[model samples]
Target: MLVSTLLERLQSDPGRPRLTWYGDDGERIELSGAVLANWVAKTTNLLVEEYDVQPGSMVGVNLPVHWRTVTWALASWRVGATVVLLDGAPEDPAAGNLDVVVTDSPDSWTGSSADLVVVSLPMLARRYDGDLPPGAVDAAAAVMTYADQIIYAPEPDPGRPALTGSGVAGAAGNAVVGHDELVPEAGPEEGVRTLVDGRGRAADVLRQLLRVWAAAGSVVLTGPATAAALEADTARRDRLVATEKIERIA
Candidate 1:
């Protein structure tokens, strides 16, 4: 299904479970499918009516790994906006590459190269409570945090894939052990690069994909500019897969 279809279904369905969010601090936030749709719709209104984020516009997201990022990214895509991940204020102001930058910290700055209409990430975060900013979507990305600095870790060897049984998957399958799941204590090889721990957030990824696909919604993975959204999205998906509702593809 397409992204819009998913949104429409959720909007029409008034009662389907949508999210199973696991915070980095080990917190859990559950959102019904209907609730998620309402939040996204409000977010979309904020982007369109408030932020003026029209179709084809580029919006930057700078949030940590959290559920808020997911809704905001989905909202941006819902309005046909390109979600740009920002590492930091661009080094130059003349770059003029972005239309908006979403940040959580009020003091966050992107730089002069990429001019942005800066806004608060908290604004989007509050959407869960149904609070949205007035002039949002007027910029490219929200003022969120993805943290700029990349740490290189050695990749793990690929292991055999196996089927997990009942009681084997708990708290989103954090316990299902696998050979490839191990990570090296040392850094990566001279030319090798890894996106994250490399234990395969497949469980989480699969869940998110399934939900989104079921919703048929479009999502932007902006790990380059505002990796916070990307990282958060990845983590959330991992949790969903581990929740036991996501079955491995045969």
Candidate 2:
């Protein structure tokens, strides 16, 4: 189904629980479907009107495993643009051909193209600079792979605390720490998504996790797995998801 379908559903159900980001430090960031819809609208405007990213154009995303990535990708699809995911490096031919590049860090894109426009995640979140496209509606959201926005929730709490959050500096939205949370020492930006502590088939486990989260949809893994070795698991998972279906969430 189109991405707009999800947005509409979420909008209609403003309180519907859509995205939840949990840190290892037992903290959590919850994004309601309503909020996600608005962000997607803003991101859509930035790509089309401000950057002139035309429909059918390829767009690159290089953000941490956070809601911003998900919203940006959805916005691109709403405009009929193809999302070129570059989780790692070497930059795929598809990504290189992108008309515009939206990333957390503009420096991440080493491509040579006058059309590539990098939209920093921090900029988008902190500032309201992008222009909105005329009559841009999230009609057709882009399909995303599970790892498109890799996420690892803090270890599940034996007893989930009230859906409350603590106030932290530079924290995206409201994130609260609970006794049962994983309390990740790193934030989403640091790229310390999950605790990939042990070795042995970590790649396989990550792949499985991606397939499950992506709703058994198509996915690709770029290169350069940071501290998480996400790239390794992404590669294996892409293949596995292609052959079979796995259902999961982060």
The prediction achieving the highest lDDT against the true structure is: 1
Summarize candidate 1's per-residue lDDT along 1-250 as a digit string, tens digits.
Answer: 3344445655554554555454444444556667676666666665665456755455665555455666766666555565554444444232145566665532444333223343333333422222334433332243222211112211222332111211223235543323233211222222111122212233333234334435323222222223344356877655544543543321
Error of 1 at 121 (Å): 7.4
- Candidate 2 lDDT, tens digit per residue, 13-107? 56644554333233344555566566666666656555665444556654454445566656665565545555544254434555666554544
RMSD of each: 16.4, 17.9
**Candidate achieving the largest TM-score:** 1
Candidate 1 backbone overlaps, count: 44
Q: Cα lDDT of model 1 overall?
A: 0.43
After superposition, candidate 1 runs with Cα above 4 Å error: 92-96, 110-212, 215-250
Q: Give the worst 10-residue stretch by lDDT in candidate 2.
A: 161-170
TM-score for each of the candidates? 0.49, 0.47
